[model samples]
Target: MEKIKNLQHSSILFGILFLFLFVIGSGYYLLRKNMLQNHKAQREIIVLDIQTKVESLLSALLHSYTLKKEEIQKKHKEVLSFLQKCGCDPLRLNLTPLYQKLNANYTPPRYNIYITDENLTIKNTTFKNDLGFSLRFAKATFDKHAKEHIIGVSTPLLEASTQKFFSYSDSYIPKTDKILQLSYTYEASSQRFQKIQHFLHKMGIVRATSYIILNDGFINKIDFATQTKEKLAQVIEKNQEDAKKILKTLQTKSRSIRQNKDLQTIYFVVDSPILKDAKVLYSITFDESDFYLKLATLKIVFLVITLFGVVGIIFLWYLRKKEIKLSYQEQFLRSAMHEIQTPLSVITLNHEMNTLKTGENEFTKEITNALQILELSYNELSFALLATKQEHKVEKLSLVEIVQKRVSYFKAVAKSMQKKIIVESEDPSCIMISSIELIRIIDNTLSNALKYSDPKSTIKVEIKQSNLCISNKGKKILDTKRIFERYFREDSAKGGFGLGLFIVNEIAKKYDIKIKVNSTDKKTTFCYHFKEAECI
Candidate 1:
């Protein structure tokens, strides 16, 4: 029996698809995790870079301020020394005319200089208005600190928006009982830094790009809103919260990823190491959507490539499995076909020898039975070898004769089983069919009759009206409709390939013979009805 449990193509397809999806899904999940981790690393790099920028900006601003203070001190010393050498007292001399002399004294036409008495009273002025800022801040700062440095003041108050940072350094003159003040503003550098809008666009800096640099003790400074590489600046008011928070909480630099669930945002706060000798917090807030957008295209391409490659690999593997399975089945069938030949030849030769010597005895019948069974096995092997591509050779033959030959062929089998075939044929029952095909039909019908019939029962084989009918008194076919289908068997215990009946039907159809089946509780009959037949 050919127990070919062949895997169906559809089943292979479904399995491959399932495997493909599982593999791709797992791969996709891993890739996404990797991409997310890489994104975090990239964000850290950007944060560190921004922090470095802020630190450098701070250093440059401190240096610029220190330079401005030193320049003011240098200029003030020069003016005061010249005034003392000329026997000039800034308070006693009509110093209002000294403004032009002072202007001419400096090559770059120095900052507005003024002389004021130590009692915080303005005595001389660059412009009479002087905004009173120079006197107020200079005196308040001078009296407040035991140690004196540049009185860097914005105005009478920190928010006083002259948009200028004033650096005031005063020199006391013993001959004058007055102090000379030199002041300058960073308005030029601030304006130039604010013009970095184009450069900011190039760097992909968005509205969220903001930072604060604390000046430690000073309330007046420039903000990054007008920041440049030349100067790091920040407004005191803008930094008040962070500055106060740091002073109160002293939060350290954090490297962990922080998330805001409500806002669906992530960020990092880098506390730069006391930049320019001042503690500062430089945090960069980024909307996650931008980074997602950046990864979206890459992710799409990756998925497409991965899916395509995975499907290709799975399909190839499926094909390989199918090919290997078929290869093994074919190899086994060939090996079986080859392996059975020696026994088959021995049985056939023994049957022939025994038939010649004993002339129709029971032992000779048994040998013939073995030979007949061997013949069927050989034919089945041939059929498997052919894979159903047998050469056709049509001939005119008497239908009754072919039926007799097949009945005689199965006679040993029938006798061993204690069953008999009763043949009734009319004269000249000739048909045009491949002789091999006709033998196949007759042998299959007779074999089924002997296999399924009750022992000692009669099988009636009749060829009348150019039609053959084989009827057996045996177990009735439960499903006559499917009895002739390949691999279908009414009784699996009666071992055969189950190919016989199906071959009968197919050959009958090919030769334009109509086949039918009729089954009852008592009898089952298979008919091969010839059409368009001619007989003499």
Candidate 2:
């Protein structure tokens, strides 16, 4: 009977083990399949989103350019009307008054305005010396197309004679159908397209290409890529064949001539055909890296989800066994806390005893200062724990007074470090803020200023209406953009958890205050602009 019982027990254990292995294998297979499906779906969505965003961006740009062209045309018509009143004599037209009026009325700066005859000969121009010259040579290509079109603008081009870059062109058609071209030139290295380019760059496009097609089969290409002009030209030429293929595919898919294409080079081609009798195609191309970046981002999300699922299973198993280990964890935490407290208490007591015995000796004072710094650090840690673990109360108090008090508290430390704290104020009134938060923000700033300031130098504090500005002479920040980020520190030698500015930023944001920093090689200033509250 005993032998029979042992055999049954062994058979039961083997069956349970086999069931576990089978379940695990099945779960792994299902998880892998689900992950692959999710990744594919995510990639498709990303590609579609990128396509939509690029289309929208191109539409906006084209619309803006079109509007600008319209405005320029309207102004040109006004100028032509004024010229007609002056009797069609180019030399006697006297465009000075009209030029002044346009300069005052125009939204953007104007470069020059020119009037041309039926033969496209320059009759009169805003630039006096260029009058009666053949502008046809310089603007002939663009003028030939502009004569038929009512309104159009040219892309950025470098003028050979002046060696300057021009960004705009506007044409007017009078009753006689003569054309007048108004041009605008901007500084080459200015921030003209910075915002637009930055937006595109953030979307992960390495380059952008735009084409303005005239009714006469003339194309004006605008390359916004960082690549050199020659390299970009080569790239465009190489991709033209691909563009034609894509155009065919788009026409087939949408059943419309105006459609976009997705190519193998991760580039998107969008074509917009004007509805007018003289149809022109506006084509734009954008890099496809954004689509892939979004896919990679989704993949990372899937990985995180998989990790969490695994952790959840392990966590559940741990919880099931937690009751058995509860006493052990509690004993360990108790012992750890005791061990830490014992050494801290010993250090505190020893410092106190030394200070009392020596009464004002350098060694005693130094030890006392060190102990105070340690105690302050422990207080900060305790405050952080309390803040995170429990609800905090918001109490309205004067920000200026709280700052003063925090500065007073740090006076001794500043003195020990041989640094002076100076406060300058343009406002004597109080500003409302949370007392604890105000103290934390100002304390951190003051501490950092004192720590980094030259040994004998003074840290200046200025208070204007709704603004608190602090300045200190220290090493310039390497990356000023990331100064308020968590765990960001300029100097490795500076002893800090690097949480001070980040905490200050959080508190400032909570209070709806604005913080700005201005730094140079000589000095750095941190300014906090507080929101104005009702006077008490």
Candidate 3:
């Protein structure tokens, strides 16, 4: 039985430990998972923010490049109209001063003009310069979109000499069938670029590279909007492997944002197609050091809190384990004491019978009462261990007989210790209580009075109609109020579990018996005053 009880207690502790571990582990996992999920959302927002800014800027740049077509065609029509009004043909026109006067009227129009004949050969015109050179290179561009009686623009063109990029347009006249084109060179440091730069600044992608790629494989960089003056292509070329991938990916059909990965850094590139075969590929290097630092700090804080919670649970488990052990040990003691009490009663009864039959000296009345008191102590211990009290059965038991029986029981021991016990009753009466419980109550009080009373000093047991009391002249009780408390002792020098008066008080209460203790410097008295029992 003891082994089974121990195993059960052990099982309970193990179960409690496992439950604590499982809860802590699950809480930690969920906390970290939630933090990571939030971090993921933040990262996506950062990426989306970068991509949206680049897309919007590219759209504006494409519009600017394409819109120049209309402006160029408009300027060219003015020249052609002036030529017809003066009755001049493209092959024979010599109006340098008129062209100069027309150009002078424009203010801050950072562009150039050109004139070409049917085969795109430079015709007789005013103010010739190498600025209109890429027009000859883009002859096929005009030829493909050339229409009679129509004016239109060309795809972007690159001047290899100066790295200047521009777009041109052509107008066809039915009167002379002369095909004339105008070239509008791009200003890299234009106010339009400033607008794009301000927009990039708003988007938080400050360190970025932007460029326009031409159909001829030459790059026209957007330098004015970048943080540094270094060319976009040159910076990308520093990482040869990523540069190849970046340039190659820009040519694919998927003109979406792409990644360029190197040993130490990552770049995001998006290419937006502008003209027939040209595109603007924009790339920005991703900076995630701040993001990582914040995430690491969050994890560390959660771990610290989680560590404290786990330690708290372990500490609680330790306290709970102690409580369970105390409970189990108390249960075993109760069971052991209860088993011993049953045989003790049998031995006590048999010894009493033998003494009456043969007047035998094997066990005297003193030894019998001692064993009986020991058995009563076991019963009290059993009740205390169970965290319960003995509910005494009340019946009319004569106090005169109880006192005489207890006095006779203690008489031999009193003589051996040279102490005399006197039972004086003004009125012998009946106490309503269980006979067994009454015996324990009388025995515990009598035992204490005998043990502590000065040897040869008479201890007095008195009985009355309403009460019984035992008075002893011995060591005074330091705390009269605490004598009836369980396991309480004024002097530990006296050997006992200190349960004697406590049990006496318990039985007294069950029978509606009020216990009172009065102590002086050298005299102490314990009295039990019973109420009248309910009559049948």
Q: Considering every candidate listed, which one attains the maximal lDDT?
A: 3
In every candidate, how many clashes are there? 4, 0, 0
Ranking by TM-score: 3, 1, 2
**What TM-score should be assigned to candidate 3?**
0.46
> In candidate 3, which residue pairs clash?
none
Better of 1 and 2 by TM-score: 1
lDDT of each: 0.62, 0.60, 0.63
Q: Candidates sorted by lDDT, descending order? A: 3, 1, 2
lDDT of 3 at 294: 67
Candidate achieving the largest TM-score: 3
Instruction: Evaluate model 2: give its lDDT.
Output: 0.60
Model 1 residue 228 CA deviation (Å) reads 29
For candidate 2, write residues 450-520 as lDDT tens digits: 87777788899888767888999987867766878755677869786566787788778777888888888
Q: Cα deviation of 322 in candidate 1 (Å)?
A: 10
Better of 2 and 3 by lDDT: 3
